[model samples]
Structure formats: C-alpha cells, structure tokens
Target chain A: MDFTPQELLIASITRMLRGLNHVAVGASSPIPGAAALAARRLSDGHLRVSVLGSRKNNFFTDGGRELFDCAAQGRIDAFFLGGGQIDGQANINLVGTGGYPRTDVRWPGSFGSAYLYFLVPRVILFREEHTPRVFVPKVDFISAPGVSEPNVYRPGGPYALLTGKALFAFDKARQRFRLETVHPGFSVADVEASTGFEFDRTAHVDVTPAPEPELLALLRGPVRDEVAETYPQFAATVMCGSDDKENRV
Target chain B: MAEHGPIVSLDALAAQVPDGALLAVPPDYSGVAMEATRALIRRGVKRLHLVAVPTSGLQAELLIGAGCVETIEAAAITLGEAGPAPRFSAAVKSGAVHIRDATCPAIHAAFQAAEKGIPFMPLRGIIGTDMLRYRTDWRTIQNPLAEGDDPIVLLPAIQPDIALFHVPLADREGNVWIGRRRELVTMAHAAKRTLVTAETIQEQSLLEDERLAAGVIPALYVSAIAEAERGAWPIGLEGRYEPDAAHIADYVRTARSEDGFRAYLAQHVLAGRRAA
Candidate 1:
C-alpha cells in the first residue's frame, strides 16, 4: 500500500507502544493521538488510550490534574513529548531559543513535561522536522532533562527519539541517543547531516519498515475518523484523502 | 444568608476584578470566561497577575496583547492547532510580562496546596531543568522520611485574588455547576474570591439535583454570579457549541501585529460590547 509519511510515523509510534497498558497523548498532538488509537486497536482493546482535549477518549474524571496524578501513581505506561529543540543527551527544550525569560524565539512553554518526564516510564520524543536547529548540540534551555540525578525522584525518562528522518533509541544509562533505524529514502549520512548533536550509530542501521496494507487501511479508515474528532485539520489535510468538511472539529 | 446575591451584569462582574489583581483563569478547552475577559479588557484593567491553572490560550494572549497582564504563571501558552499565541510570544520576547514558568503538575499541585491551606507542596521531577533556576519561589528539599538521599521540588502555594470562569449553569442561589471540569472547584477554593459567569441562571438550586450535586461548586466559594448567554463565545462551551474555528483563525491572522490586534480589539471586542 502507498502510505503517507504521517501513516508511516503513526505505524512507527504504534509499534513502540506495544506493551504499554495505557498511553496518553497530550494536546495539539495528532500523530501521537492517532498512533495511540491504533495501538489500542491492535491490542484488542487491551491498551487504553487517552487523548487530552477529546471528550470521548479521555477517562480522567478529576479534571486536568488527574492525568498527572495517574502518571505519578504509575498508571500511565507511555506518553509522547515534542520539543522546539532536543539535544544529544535527550534534553528537550519546549521553552524557546536563547537565554531564560528573554528568549530569541519563544515556542510554547513546557506543559507537563517537567513532571511527566519523571513519572511516565516510556516517553517517546517525537519531532517531525529533523533539522540541525531542532536536533541541536545542546538545547538553549532544558524544559525537561532527558536524564536526572540518582537522588532525584524520577522513574521516567526518554526511551526513544523518532523524527521524520530516522528512529533512535535513547540509552538512558549512557545519556545519549543511538541510531536504530533510518526511514526509507533517508540515508545514515542524511540523518547525520541534518542532526546538530553527536549520536552513536549501530554498525548496520536497519531500514524502518513500511506500514502494512492492513495497518494502512486501519489508519485511513477508523483511525482517521477517530483522530478527526480531536485534530480535524490534521485528519483532513494529512490523513490521506479525507475532505469531509462536516467532520471538522 | 447567601454567600452571593443576585446575578450582576457582565461589566459589573468585570468591575469586581481590581487592577493588578492576581486573577486565575482556566485553560481553553475547560470553561473560560471569554466574555468576562473582554469586559476586563474594556475596563482597561492593568497589571493582572494571571494564573493559568495549567495552561492557557486565546484569552491570555488577548489580555497580554491588550496590555492587561503584568505577570503570567502558566505551564504553557499556545493557540492549540492554530499555532503559537502571537501576542504572548511578542510580550515574552520584549520582556513585557514576567513569566513564572511552571510544569502542569506543579501548577496543579500549588493550587491544591492553596486549596488545602498548606504553605507548600512537594512534587517529583523538575530537579535538573532550568525551571528550577528561574522559578526562585520553588524550592528543593530532601525527603525527611526516606532513608536514601531523595530530593523533591517544593512549590509555594499560589492563592489568587480572584478566580473567574464561565459555566453552563449557575443557580439563583449562586451554586455553579461545573460538571466534570473540577479544576474550577480547585480554582474557587484556592482564590480569595470567585467570580462566575454562566450561560443561564437556572430556577432551581443545582445541589437539589442529586446527579449534579457532585459537579456543583457550592455558593460558599462563589462571591458573585453573572448571567451572560453564550459567554464562552468563540472558545465555546462543552456540549453547547463547537469552537468558531473561522473566527479563531481570523483572530490568529489579525493578532499577528500590534496594529492588527488593535483593529481586532476595536471591531470585535470594544465595538461588539456595545451591541452585546
């Protein structure tokens, strides 16, 4: 099946969330949300998916704090985080470029990352635009450190970093990202050229497998409809050929 | 005696909020009092210390652009799918507003501490990040009970002067039904005073209904109530209406620059108030 880049990304994310009991996707995250939904579908309703900002998917009854509370109690197995800049050590900067307070450029401030990056065991760092600017030598600011001191009460940290170009697994013990696979049409040199930070690569980097026909159908049909409920623009524009204006949320 | 009396006009409700007040507001998806926000803008309220329970959107941006906010304590401020909140970004870049950067849980935990009448609340994480350095008010302490060298961050309680939000219903007796969005309850509890604007003033007391009693924030916390129909306009109230995406898109476009933002304020906010 001819799959879109978004579908491929979704499939990659879905595979990563294989064993997680409950996966939570935060606000303004369409790809992660779709992938979580797909993971639930593949898990035969075993994997619980909660997408914030969605009336149907979210199960938190105690308002906004419930998600954090749940994560702190180890209820949430996996969560997704994105950054304005991500460094070699998996330090994600959601704040902005330049110094504290007065930044050269300002992205959205860190939301739950400071807390969630500590509690939730598996945090998939997803950023579509894999450029030197995004994957930096060191982030201008660390909104949430990828690793913490031994004394810090942190059970969660970076597990993997997935970008448009390649997939890299975070070696938390070593405090670095190791290249696991390069996506189709992208070479090891391409990943190295685009990335600003240094990373360890496997002797032979594997090609990220394409989405299966069945998975593509699932993504296009059910996942698209479900994701459209939360992110209508993403669903309409990027989730294959769906131009249902009425479904625009 | 009732904690609050009869419903006031939207402008009157806005008047209750003093300039430089520490005002707490909800996130966009939650119940946001957009009409009340416009009223605050119209009144030319200044130096507001905005506490966005966790995060905020158009409302905070609008206030910042209007030069109402002096400081904003929030987890994040973005326009959701519409992209970055332009005015907020501009203000931060120019150092127009003092930002007390906080994580989502820390904000909630601080509010929870305020609600519980505690001086501070200890939270895990935020140990090595720059947030620790910038947020001087937040402190780190070793766990006294633990045997190991366990370190945790402690956030001081944030007690806002006023907590304001829009809801689906507010009873004549001032009991506001917030449904599942219980963050409003926390906001009301954490603030010194609570101002509420509702879509309708229901005839019966909300607590009378056993089903709704759980979701209702009793009149004791609510200082005043105002009836403003379709109050969460453009942002929309849950189960009531969808967000006016086109209008928001128009706002995103118009709020890109100072001149355009002023034009928006004139046409949509100041002028619309008269018609409203």
Candidate 2:
C-alpha cells in the first residue's frame, strides 16, 4: 500500500513511543500529535496523549502551568522538540540564528524546551527539513543543550531525532547520534550529504520498515479523524487522500 | 464609583492603564483581551512594558505594531499556524522594541514568585541557554540547601502594574470564570490591578456555584470588569468560538507592510469597530 511522507513519519514516531506512559505534543506539531494518538491506539488507550491547543486531547485542568509543573514532577514520559538549528551534540536552537536580542533570522524563541527538555525523559528531537541549515555543527544559540553535567538535576535529554531523511538515536554517553534507520527512498549517502553533523552509523544501516497494514488502517481511520479536530489543515493536506471518501476504511 | 469597582466601559477599562505601566497579558489560547487591546490602542496608551506570560500571538503583535508597547518580554511570540508574527519580528530587528527574551517556565515561575509575594524563584533548566546570558535579572547560584554544587537559575518576581485578559463570564460580584486557564489567576495575583473584559456579566455570583468556584477568580482579585461580547475576537475565546481564520489570514497578509497594517488598523480596529 502506498503512503504519504506524513504517514511514514507518523508511523516511525509511533514506534519510538511504544512503551511511553504519557506523551505531550506542543502547538504546531501535528505530526507528533498524530503519532502520540497513534501510539495511544496501539497501546489500547494505555498511553495518555496531551496535544496542546486541543481541548479533548489535553487533560490539564490547573492551567497552562500544569504541563510544565507536571513535567517538573516527572509525569510526562515523552515529548517532542524542534529547532531552526540542531547541533551534533543534540543542542537545539528554537531561537533564531545570530546574536541575542537582535537575531538576523528569528524563528520563535524557545517556549518550554528550556525547562521540559531537562524534565521529560524521552525528548524526541523532530524537524522535517533535515538539511544542513537545520542540522548544523553548532547552533547559533542553544535553547536547550542535549547533555548536562553530572551535577545538574536533569532527568531528561534527547532520546532520538526523527527527520524526513532518517532516524538517529542519541547516544547520551557518547554525546552523539547513532544512525538507526534511514527512511525509505533515501540512501545513507543522501542522509550524509544533507546532515551537517557526523553520527555513528552501523556498517549496514537498514531502511525504516513501512507502516504495518494494521497501523495504517488505525492511522487512516481514528487517528486521522481525531487529529483533524486540532490540525484540520495538516489532516486535510497530509493525512487525508483525495480518494479517501470513507475515512473509517 | 472607584476605579476598581463594578463593570466599566471598554474605554474606561483601557483608560485605567497608565502610560508605561508593566502590563501582564496571558498567551493567546489562555484568554487574550483583543477588544481591550483595541481600546488601549484607541486610547493611544503608550510605553507599555508588556509581559507575555510564557508566550503570545496576534494580540502582542497588534499592540507592538500600534506603538502601544515599548518593551515585550516573552518566551516566544508567533501567530501559531500562520507562522512568524510579522510586527514583532520587524520591531525586534529594527530595534523598535526592546526584547527581553525568556523561556516559558521562567516566566511562569516569576509570576508564581510574585503571586507568593517572594523576591525571586529558582528554576531548574535554562542553565545552558543564552536566555541566561541576556537575562541579567536572572541569576545562577548553587543550591543553598545542597551540600554540593547544584546550580540553578533564579528569576526575579514579575509584578506587573496591571493584568488584563478576556474571559467567558464575570459575575455581578466581579468574579470572573476562567475555566481551566488558571494562568489568568496567576496574572491577576501577580499584577497590582486586574482588569477584565468578559463576554457577559450575569446577575449570579460566580463563587457561589460549586462547579465554577474552583475556576473563578474571586471579586477581590478582579479590580474592574467590562462586558465586551466576543472580547477575544479574531483570536476567538476557547470553547466559545473558533478563531476567524479568514479574517486573521487577511491580517497576516495586510500587516506585512506598514501602509497595509495602518489600513487594517483603520478599517478593523480604529473604525469604531468594537467587539460586537
């Protein structure tokens, strides 16, 4: 069965979230949102997914601070972080490139990554465009570092990085990413040319497995419909096919 | 009537905000008083040291573009799905506005410190980021309680002169129902004065109801209230209505240029188009 790139990404990310208890996705992260929902479906509703900006998905009642407060207490199991620039050390810069206060190119300043990155254990670094501009040797600014010193009370850091090109698992001890699986249709050479940082790759890097028919059915059915509530545009353009008259199918 | 008493007109609510006051406003989803924002612009309230608790969206952009703000401290400011906020970016790049870049929890923790009437609060993360370098007000010290070195960042309390936001309802007693958005309560608690714009002011007392009492900021915290139906227009109030995406898209397009932004202001904001 043919699938869109978004479907591929969603499936890949869901696999990363296999045993996680609770996954929280932030704003403008439809792909992660869908993945978290897909993970929940796979877990038979065991996995709790909180997608910010969605009333149904999020269970926080105290307020916006609840998510951070909960994470500080180590309630959130997995979360996603993206950056305009991500370095080899797994340092991510959500803030723009250049000097402070007056960056030449400003994306958005780091929201909660500065806090959540340290608190949430499984921080999945995500960004679709995997070019050198994004995957830099050194980020102009470090919104959150991938590693902290021994004394820092950090229970969390980067777990793995999923990009359009491939998936790289962060080797925390080594402070470098190890090439896990290159996405289908992309070669190891293709990933190498695109990536700015060097990573440890096995002699034989396997292609990422295609989405199982069961997972695809689940994604195309309930997950697609559910994610559409918060991310209509992404669902419409990426998840839903022109031929998908019956979404439940 | 006292400045803090009863429901006032939107203009009157705006008038209470003195020039150059440190104003605390919640993020877009929390409850943004867009109508009151327009009222402030109409009143030409200037030099507001706007604090976007955690983050912000169109409301901050509108305020900055209209020259109502001198400084803006936020973790991040964007138009969400619409992409980067134009005016905020322009203002920052041109040095038109002073930017005190912050992280989300630091901002929240600061407000919490103020709410607790503390001088500062210690936060765990933000140790390695440039946010620490630029934010001189935020200091790093070894954990006083720990025997060994456990450095943490200390954020000074942020007690804004005024806190303003829109909510779904306010009672006759001046208590406003904020539902799950308790950041508004923190904003109310941290600020010296809390001005509110609500969709409706019912005769009923909010605190009297059991279900809503937990969500309601009692009359003591709410200084004044203004009944502006659809107060969070274009941005939309959570649960009440969806954002007018088409209108906001038009704004995103129009506000890309100075001339176009002014035209948008004249037609949409300054044209006596109060939130109806």
Candidate 3:
C-alpha cells in the first residue's frame, strides 16, 4: 500500500484526537484541517471542526473575538499551531530564527499561537520541515513558550508535536518532549541527524500507522471535499487521486 | 438633512485626527482605509501610536515607511501569502520606531478590555518568553478567583483615540455595513471615535433591511463618513474586490529600500492617483 506522507501524519494526529468535542484549525493549516475533518467524519459528526478561512466551516460572526471567547470559555477542545522554530521545551519561534529585534531570518511574526497555546487544552504543534534549523537547542525569540510555571493560569499547552519525521508527546510536568513514534520509512537516527534540540528518546519507538483503505477512501472523498472548502490548494495538490491509488495496487 | 450628518471628505475626516493620536486600523484582508492612510501621510502626522488590534500588513508597512507612525503595537505584520513585509521588518530591525511585540489574543484582549471599560484583562500564556520580559505594561498576577495560586498575564486595556477602516457601503444616516467583520465594530467600541470610508453611499438607512441592519455599525459610534469608491484598493475591501495583487507586489518590491520607498510614495500616494 502506497500513501502520501501527509496521509500518514493525518492518520497519526486523528488517532491522537479520538473523541475531542471540537477542534479549530486556523490560518494556513491544511494538514491539521484534513485530520480534523477526517476525525469529524470518522466520529459520524460527533466532532465539530472549524476552519478559520472557510466561509462555510467557520461559525464565528464576531471576527477574532468569537474564536478567542470560545477558547477562553473552554468550548474549544483542540487547536493546531506551527512555528518558524520549535525547540525541545515546546517553545515556538514564529518571529524569526535569529535575535528578534534584528534577525538573520524573518518568518511571519507569531499570529495567534501565543494566545491559542494557552487556552486550548490540546495544542498540537505541527511543522512539516524536520531539520536542525527548525528544531533548535534554544529559539532566538520565544513567540510562545511550551510550559508555564505552577502559579500561571494555564489550562492548555503543547500536547504533542508532529513533524515530517516523527511525533513527540510533550510532558508538561517535566517540561520535556518524549519521542513517541517515528514515521514509517524513517528512523530515530534520521530524527537525530536533523534535530538540533535534545529530548527524551525512547528505546522502542512504534512506527506511525499507515492510513488503511477505508481511511484512505474517506480522506480522498468526503474529507478532501470538506478540506477543499478552506484549503483548496492543499486538497487539490495532496489528496491521492483514485487513478494513482488504483495503479499503486 | 441628518443634522450635521456623518458624510465628509477624506481630508476633512483625516484633518480631525489630532497630533500624536493613538489610531486603530483594520487588518490587511478587511476594509483598510488606504485613502485615509494617504491623507494622514500627506498631512505629515507625527508620533502616531498605530495599533493593529492583533495583526496587520501593508498599511502598517506604508505608515511605518512614510514616517507617520512613531510607535507600533501589533502581534505581527506580514504581507500574508505575498511574503514578509519588508518595510515593517526593516523598521523593527533598524529600531526606527518603538515596537511592542505582542501576541494576537493579547491585542484582542486589550481592545476587548477597553471595550468593556476594564482596567486590564487576564490572559493564559507567554509567561516564560522574552517577549513577556520586555513588556513593561504587562504584569503577571496570581489568580485570586481560582482555588490554587495560579499565575495569569494581564494586558492593559487599549483605548485608541480613533478607529479608522474602509467599508463596502454606508448610508446617509451615518451607519455603515460591516457585515461579519465585527472586529471593526470592536475597534469602534474600543476607540473614542470611528471614521469610515465606504465604497458606495446608500440613500436608504442600512437598518431598514433586516439582513443589512444586523451588520450596521450605528451612526452613534461613527464620527465621520466619507464616500470613497475602491477606498481599500491595493488592500481588498473583502467581497467588494480582490486585493490589487500586482500593485501590492510592486509595493513589496519597492518598499525594500529607503530610496525605493520614497519613489513608491511619490509615484502612488503623493501623486494622489487613487485619491477619492
């Protein structure tokens, strides 16, 4: 069976968010959008997914306030965030790689990750590029820190980080990231070579499960359409064509 | 007819803006009053406190480049998919203006606090970052309401002197249809006054139609209204038209250097090519 790397990641994230009540995907999160859409379809509409850019999917009438208000009130269960650089402590740098006032590289400054990371219970940190530059020892600027002190009124933080190479679950108590699984066709060594930060490496990491035929069908058909409304470019590019799937078999 | 009604010209409305005013503007995607921005630049406004609520784009860049802004408080400023906003990046890097780097919700919450007439609003995250370290205004306090001594970040309320934005339509009665872009409404409520530029002027009250009524920002909040067709040009008016991508691309290209930026200003803005 041949599947896209995105499908593998989508399946892994969907597995993590088994019974969430509601998930909101913001800005330019196509993969997370697909996974949320997939999870919603899998649960027979038990899950409510809101893609911010989509006119049809977004339920917010009051601009950014509705999203924030909902999150503050604990109505939103999960949200997806990405960064220019994500470190070992789950600290994300959306601003840039070097010193923020004047940086070597300037990514788009942090949009809502700093705010969303605090309110949403399950914050899934997703970045496709797995490299030393992105996975740093210490981010030049902390757009949003992964962990908060005991006294801080934080209901949410990083639950897991999904990269192109591996998935790591964040342990808030210890403020450490534990490598849960390495994607199939990739090894711990591959992760080690590319990553800049040190983390708790597990001895026996499970291979991320591939999307089965049923899941693939759902992803290609309904999930693709649902995601297309918000991420037309992503859906058009990433969704596995039926002809390609038939040929693969 | 409506007793010193809201209808006014861009310059007349822009003239009302006092020196060193804290002005709130909309994001790039929404109705950004480019006409008003040009007028502000031409007026040689000084030491302006420009607030983007959460995020901004070319408007922030344009103002920063034109030297009309003295302080910028925004979560982030980018050209969105078009790429990094060069002028804003250079301004921050060069330490041209005082930059208060904040998160999106923090900005939103600050405005919200002002809208609610509160002193400050408590937020959830960024207690551990360097961004928090530099912010003199933000303070961390333990949750008094919660059972345990939980800490929370408190953002000071932002009360802008003027809230300026563009709209697709405004009635003679001064009401403007903001539709689902209620952030404009929030800006209006938070600011002392709101100035609007509508693409078209509606003769009938927008409140007459139930559908349009719901989106109307009542005349009471609006200080002045200007009829400027394609007012948000270069930046889109949302549903009215797509952003003039070619012109914006040119802005990105020209905004790279001081000389290029001057040329850009003289050619487009100083020429008053699109002035309404």
Q: Scoring each candidate complex against the real one, what DockQ results?
A: 0.86, 0.78, 0.55
Deviation in Å, model 1, residue A88 alpha carbon = 0.5
- The alpha-carbon root-mean-square deviation between model 1 and the true structure, to one decimal in Å, is 2.9
Instruction: Give stretches of model 2 more than 4 Å off.
Output: A242-249, B1-4
lDDT of 1 at B257: 88
Q: lDDT by residue for model 3 over A49-164, one digit each (tens)?
A: 88876676777888876888798899999999998888999999988766656676766677788778888999999999999989999888888889876666688889999999
**Tens-digit lDDT string for candidate 1 (A183-241):** 88899999999999999987899999898776777887898899998998888778854
Model 1 lDDT, residue B79, Cα: 86
Per-candidate fnat, comma-separated? 0.90, 0.75, 0.71
Q: Pairs clashing in candidate 1?
A: none
Candidate 1 chain B superposition, TM-score: 0.97
Residue B102 local lDDT, model 1: 88
lDDT of 2 by residue, B129-202 (tens): 87888888999999999998899999999999999999999987899999999899999999999999998899
Q: What is the lDDT, from 0 to 100, of the residue A34 in candidate 2? A: 92
Q: Candidate 1, which segments miss by more than 4 Å at Cα?
A: A242-249, B1-4, B274-276
Which pairs, if any, clash in model 3? A151-B150, A151-B151, A152-B151, A153-B151
